[model samples]
Target: MASPTTAPARDASREALTDSPPVDGARAPGRRARMPLRGHLRELRTRSLWVAVGLAVGALLGWALYDPLLALLTRPLHLAASTEHRDIALNFTALGAPLDIRLKVSLFLAVLVTCPWWLYQVWAFITPGLTARERRYAVGFLGAAVPLFLGGGALAWWVLPHAVNILASFAPEGTSQLVNAQDYLTFVMRLVLAFGVAFVAPVLLVALNLAGVVRHEPLARGWRWAVLAAFVFAAVMTPTPDALTMVLVAAPICALYFAALGVAVWHDRQVDVRV
Candidate 1:
């Protein structure tokens, strides 16, 4: 019923209305992809299964290397024994202590040994949520995490003898120091794990920066507090009263925090320039 020119105008108006952004400048909604609940549950099961398999393999390998690992763990005790000239050796009070210690140690060692594989599984699970830039950052984080974790363990090894010596000093001059095998090994394993987590924590701070959850200024300004907290954390967690061991543990963490802050600042600069 309309004329040709009027019909064209009507079509143009309709197209404009459909094509325009929303009133508040928000983008028009598009069809979003969705996954069913069953699919999500299946994905979680697959990832969890892979991680469990990796842990099992690592634990098996650790159990296989039990003799060498035992020697490695006993060295600090030996060193302290030598310093005191007490000929002290680790003793098991319970019948099943030896086997139980190995099992527990293997479980802890599995986390360290299978780190890369389990970390990849985590990355894969989250890959859908990450942008390309975030993926690249993730690669860097993984690279840094492994070495930092190993370094922390090595530092713990160095600190252990000192810690053992300090703790032994508390005994009276003539008392025989019989170290409990289970308790000592558990303490040592937990110490290493704590240090490993502490070392890798800076990676998380950098991640927050990259994700724009935090900025560099606040982190940099918080340096004094970071240093105090680091020392306090080290003192509480090290199981040693020696200031040297606490400082050794705290110093690297502070260094890593500043280093991560520098990276965040660089990233922010690049973004500002791009903008």
Candidate 2:
């Protein structure tokens, strides 16, 4: 019933219809690639499985090195007690406490040992969505983050002895400074982990800068806020409530924040030049 003059238009419409994808099975052209909820859940499971494997391997390593690591952790206690001519050491009030401590230590050590691997697994999962340039920045971020974390842990380790000495010096004359094993270990681990995470946070800020999500001007103008945050983090995280120890904790982080700011500024300049 179509007019003869519209025959070419009808033919072209039919051809286009034939070339078009099926509505039930295909996404529209120019739509961004997005995974369904089911796909996201599957990806999460896969990443979790690999992370568990890394933790298991790290646990084994922790078990193998338990004795030496225990000694290393107890060094500050030894130094403090020995200086006071006392043999006061970590004590447990319950029967199964030793086993509990071992399990705790193993778990914590596993987290520390497998951190980079687990982080890489996380990155690998998210990388498919990122551009090549974004991937490069992410890898650079991971690299910078790992070393800074280790360095922060090292700083915590160094600070612990001084902090211990300061606390012990406050003990009343002729009394031993007894400590609960579980509490001491928990405190020590939290301090190290806190410092480690704090150091890593600045890397995220720098990464954002590199991604053009944040500018150097705001970051530079917010130095006071950063310093305040550093002090608050230190006050909350450090085991003891000493001003000196808090200062020690905050000082390095503030310095690192400035360093990160400098790097981000330079990187923004480079990006501007490129643009």
| Candidate 1 segments whose C-alpha is farther than 4 A from its true place | 1-35, 233-248, 270-275
Local accuracy of candidate 2 as per-residue lDDT tens digits, 143-210: 88899999999988888887676667677777876689999998898879878888998898987887
My TM-score estimates for the predictions, one after another, are 0.78, 0.75
121-201: candidate 1 lDDT, tens digit per residue? 888777655555656777898899889989988887787788788787777887788889988987998878788888998
CA RMSD per model (angstroms) = 6.6, 6.9
Error of 2 at 72 (Å): 1.5
Point out where model 2 deviates above 4 Å: 1-37, 211-213, 224-251, 267-275
Model 1, global lDDT: 0.83
lDDT (C-alpha, whole model) for all candidates: 0.83, 0.83
